[model samples]
Target: MKIIKYLLNSTCLLLIFSINPIRAQVTIGSDIEPRNGTILDIKQNSNTGHNPNAEGGLGLPRVRLVNPNTLTIDSDTEKSKYIGVTVYNTGNAGVPEGLYFWDGNTWRLSVSVSSYGNDGQFLKSDGKGSFDWSTFVMPDYKYHRPTQISVLKSANVKPESYSYQRLTDGGTGSFGGATPSAAFEYLYSDELNILSETANEKYLFIGIAATTRTKTINNNVPRTSYWQIVGIDIDLTDKNGLNVRTLQKNQRLYKTAGGSDLRSYVDLFTIVPITGVGKGSYTLKIKVYNVENTFSRNTGSEGGNFVTTETRFYDINLVDINFILYEDD
Candidate 1:
């Protein structure tokens, strides 16, 4: 009877143990069970009920590393197991103090610290995975002058044949007339060459100064002469035939009327800024166009009584032409 009783108690205890399975999880600072799939859970004590102002933190082990490239672990087998290990480094032996991690072969700095750079210096990436402090560099300014100058003048023809009438009983006429003829001519041009060594992403600043002189003759009837720079174009072309033209039109130079043997001179100055230029062999060209109006008119009833005017372009001189290159922002 005593043996049966002892066996019955043992069987009952075994049944109770089998019904409630044992867990390998651990929970600290609280009596609650550890979360599912978690081997260890740590939190602040909740003895005084849940407190919103609870303060708790986990601190990593601090160490002083002599060199980040070399690991101090003597056992190669043990070092392999510390590939993902991380620690806070307290500066020592020239190594900066920061968070570092073992990257299988060496320890690498995990954070960029301001203490690594001096004042007014910036941390720059090496395009790889490394960074270093670098000093700021200012933009450089370069100057270039025109190498060649040329002009394309109008054909030596009568003033009445080349020029047109500006005002009459009819109405206001077009500046260049019906079609672009000798009346509108390419007066002047300046060329500048940019070599490959000086080609870069920059701003091309162009400064031009030109002077023009004109002569007009007035008969018995009222006669007038008008001549001006109708257009200014900058043609930039590369070796591969990439062309870009920046043009300004109707830039007046001179205008006068109703005087015999009348001579007039005018000066023109302009500055053009061209941005976003790329690296290449480029030809910088400036083209200036001349437009004039000196047509003859018949005022009297007879055809012989014709009022004819003669106008001529004495000179179109380029006083100064300069090109400057500035680094683009």
Candidate 2:
């Protein structure tokens, strides 16, 4: 009887062990796209008069998880159009992780971290500007400076002498604004200046501005910075995409400021950079927004003109011309 009892007991223990299950807490990594849902409660209660736009329009919610199980939104607005997600963890063990949003063309890192109580609802923004989510992350605005720092590293040109042809919208009669407050501002770097190979001559001119390329300066920080084009070269491409007959080396001041990415400019034939510098001394024809359906050419008819009118020729130094370069990655 004792032997039989021992066998039954052992069998029962084995059965219990086999039926036991292990629970795996999912650490939603960067790829998980959250679903978009309206935070009706916040919307109805918030004081901000602006109606927030909805988040996560694409197949997946625009939000992504960056750190393991750490969800953050990086904003302080109590009610704003924001990326939303659903999760299983709640209560004391459910510390909210950082959340990220994917802007249509690119992924925007969320600026805040949210917490879900035992009820599984995200708490409102924490009142710090850091948590504000109303302004969507713009990959275009990711970096205000140039991405290629190597290009400017060796350049020792004096200020005011170095100039570039800034590109903007031809329609606006000026540069476009990325924000409402800073409309039509120049987008070039004030710290940069360039001299043309040719100067003090009667010829069309172009300007080349400093451009920067960047690498991760600090990786431990979660906030993302970007490589930006920042400035432009003074030369213009004609209707046929050819540069105009202007001297290969001339200078022009890029006076317009503010606004990133999209800007305006005039047609090729008319001289630009009209207002900023001394008359006949500087004019900006090319802008950042010169890209589009309009045909490009090497002549003014095609929105092309001389980048410079100076008598100095750059043929000898052409071999070492640094058109493009990057910093150490």
Candidate 3:
């Protein structure tokens, strides 16, 4: 029975050798001697005498430790003795129960860490073997952080009308997406969803509309205030007087001359914090004023109502109004 001298601590071997001849090689686990081109080979099992591949599997020694993996570390003597030691875990849920080893400092797992998740999903562990695999929570999604949400809305009105009839094509909906929401309606006003109508949250409102009209004016200064564009305003059912946003300070002329065709747009935006008096759903409203058929004639009075032709706050046609509401904070 030959053995690798390095593996055995025994000193009973003889050193007899022929003159100028090489030493014989060592072989183990086989009595027929190792095959050519082999140095130290491990083959058949010692107890069963069958080849290693034909048996159940190769086996290694397992050491049972006393109170393993406490927050208090083990002593150096225990660390050195258990350095490459494999054990069946009777404790420590953070590691696998099948195979764990002490790599001189900590215990390592021999199992897999990728078997719990699928595509578009990731494994979230609680620093233990337990994991939760779910869909990725995107920051830009509406359910996540403060995202820019756009509502595709439109309203139609005649020349000089205060009633802003919400337009509905039976196919379009709020949020500018394909998904139709019942909260937005053509016959009813739009219920702007701004996270929550509660306090401590801030909101921003911006509105833009294109106006189409014609006016007649001779002097550029002796004003023709027929085709007028005013600021956009919002009305809160719970809080009045512009808490979330009241009106924009924008005014323009859609017509300036006798045959001058006017095509203009009105843009208005404002920032509002909800720490004020309003605490309910927000409704987008338009601002209207009664402009007496007054011409700003720099003749006698400073921009006074000179020519009184007709007096009425008639409605004007708004091609489309784009209302954008988002969280400022």
TM-score against truth, every candidate: 0.34, 0.14, 0.32
Sorting all predicted structures by lDDT, with the top scorer first, yields 1, 3, 2
In model 1, the runs with Cα more than 4 Å from the true position are 1-171, 174-185, 195-201, 211-229, 239-242, 253-266, 290-320, 326-329
lDDT of 3: 0.43
TM-score of 1: 0.34
Tell me the lDDT of model 1 at 103. 89
Report clashes for each candidate as comma-separated counts.
0, 81, 13
Weakest 10 consecutive residues of candidate 1 by summed lDDT? 153-162
Write the residue-wise lDDT of candidate 2 on 1-329 in tens digits.
99999999999999999899954332132222322332122222223347542332333333333332344344324213333443222223223333334332222335544333434344346543224223334474221222222222233332212111232222223223222222222232222122222331122222244321111112111122211123223443334445432221222223222223222222112222211111122222222221212111113232112112221100011011122211111
Per-candidate Cα RMSD to the true structure, in Å, reads: 18.4, 29.2, 16.8
Instruction: Give a tens-digit lDDT track for model 1, residues 96-135.
Output: 6778899877888775744677899988875533467899
lDDT of 1 at 312: 32
Better of 1 and 3 by TM-score: 1
- Candidate with maximal TM-score: 1
Q: lDDT tens digits, residues 1-329, model 3?
A: 35666435354333333344765655565565564666754555343334342234446545344434531244655676667767656544344444567777777755545466688886666565445676777585332234345444444333334321222211132112122122221221355555544443455544545442222233123244344434444454333434454533556544443333333454445554444433455555544332222223223453323222212112344444444444434
Q: Pairs clashing in candidate 1?
A: none
Scored by CA lDDT, what does every candidate get?
Answer: 0.51, 0.28, 0.43
Which residues of candidate 2, in runs, are more than 4 Å off?
A: 1-184, 187-202, 205-207, 213-282, 285-329
